[model samples]
Target: MANYFVGDIQGCYDELMQLLSKVDFNPSRDQLWAVGDLVARGPGSLPTLKYFQQLDGAANVSLGNHDLHLMAVHAKVKRANPKDKLEALLDSSEINSLIGWLRHQPLHQELPEHKIIMSHAGVPPQWDLNTLRAESLRVTQALQSADYVENLLTKMYTSGSNQWHLEMGELEKRIYCINALTRMRFLHSDGRLDFECKVSPAECKDPDLTPWFALEGKVNQSHTLVFGHWAAVMGEVSSTRIKALDTGCCWGEYLTLWHLEKDEKITQNKLKKS
Candidate 1:
């Protein structure tokens, strides 16, 4: 029985299937923990959603920004971006159920036994575990509430400083959602998210923003974190504690999966011929 952590499977159903086969994934024995963004961008969004939906009990997903955007489009709260190839998903008969399951997923998943936390993106450098827990609950409540999750998801996009401030308003909530779901890459010296940087360390502006893992001093050393937003972040990898599995699979890059307890990389499947 293995607990496998997969990277952003953004509509790459074929690649995902190949990777799973390479790893010999056993739904009955192995648990699949996804870093989210299961749909969007790639070729097979519908099948990806259906696959995960079928694996309901065997899998756990944290909501990714793309997933939220898909939901928002369905709710009629936001228009679909031209770049998003989600028309198939929107047109599918299972749209309601697929998006519903995606929306109901939590933003943060904590595994006490493994002492690990899983989310689509990384936790901010300024937040400790306690603060993260509280904030996660707050966001979870807002998303789960019957009020206006679509509005919230539609507004989620920005660069928020690492610190959590209760004094923040709607914009901050949006920023928080972005930071939690997507648009997070570099952290400013003061811990603010640098939403503009998407390049490697060589191209990114120095002295202002650094990788999320660089903020380790701010987080508890005891707990492990498994995340998948930064596909470019490959070096400085950790097995027993921290892992970044999103090796840019959606961009014709390798798809990765890591087994947590064994602290070993189970599979590294390259994308199949398009």
Candidate 2:
């Protein structure tokens, strides 16, 4: 059996299908690991969710910011952004099941045997694999709890609160963790999240801001980090330990899939323009 790690699909169902076909993926024999944002911005959000849902045990996902937004919108905690094209997904009769499945997905996934880790955004520089796993579990628990929509998802929308302090409450810490693992892209020199910067490192206006993966001696060097979520970077990072898979499929770019064992990359072009 082979393992394939795919980038943020972002509701590009046709591209996903074509990518699978290109790789000749076998659901029973090959495992699919998706770097989240499985829905949003493209034309087939509902179909994408349904297709992944039906994959059952063969597919594993790390939840992305867009995926969480869909959950919040479904729970009426947030309004659906029209640009996301998520209305069809929210209107689906199986919205509950879809959102439930999404909530159960963790913020990070580790393939110890392959020495690879996956997340929507790169893992925080301060967090090792063990800490990442533990913190991800905490977020998962909050998301899967009975009052998840009102208690956790609703409180997680506000940004610019990325710093973690020892005296913070459980809710505050959880929100911070959520933002760090899902929404983070750049970090200020003080290690605070730089949410305002979305351009490539060289193009960034703030010289003090650095990409999360570029923090010197920060990432766990033993394992390779595979992630999506900063489409503006266009799958470029200076570190050998970092692999960026988000080639912006929903924005009419290529959908990338990395084969773990073989270290091979297969891509499929977008079927429609954004």
Q: Supply every candidate's count of residue pairs whose N, Cα or C atoms clash at under 3 angstroms.
A: 0, 0
Model 1 misplacement above 4 A: 158-163, 169-174, 217-220, 235-240, 268-274
Per-residue CA lDDT of model 2 for 115-189, tens digit only, reads 888889888787766667777888999988998877898898766468866676778778778888788899988
The best candidate in terms of TM-score: 2
Model 1, 77-189: lDDT tens per residue?
77987676888889999898887677677877877897888888777766778767776666667666676454465555434434457687755754575574455678777
Q: How far does residue 248 in candidate 2 sit from its true spot (Å)?
A: 0.8
For candidate 1, the lDDT comes to: 0.74
Q: How well does each candidate superpose onto the true structure, as a TM-score?
A: 0.89, 0.96
Worst 10 residues of 1 by lDDT: 155-164
100 in model 2: Cα distance from truth in Å?
A: 1.1
lDDT of 2: 0.86
Clashing pairs in 2: none
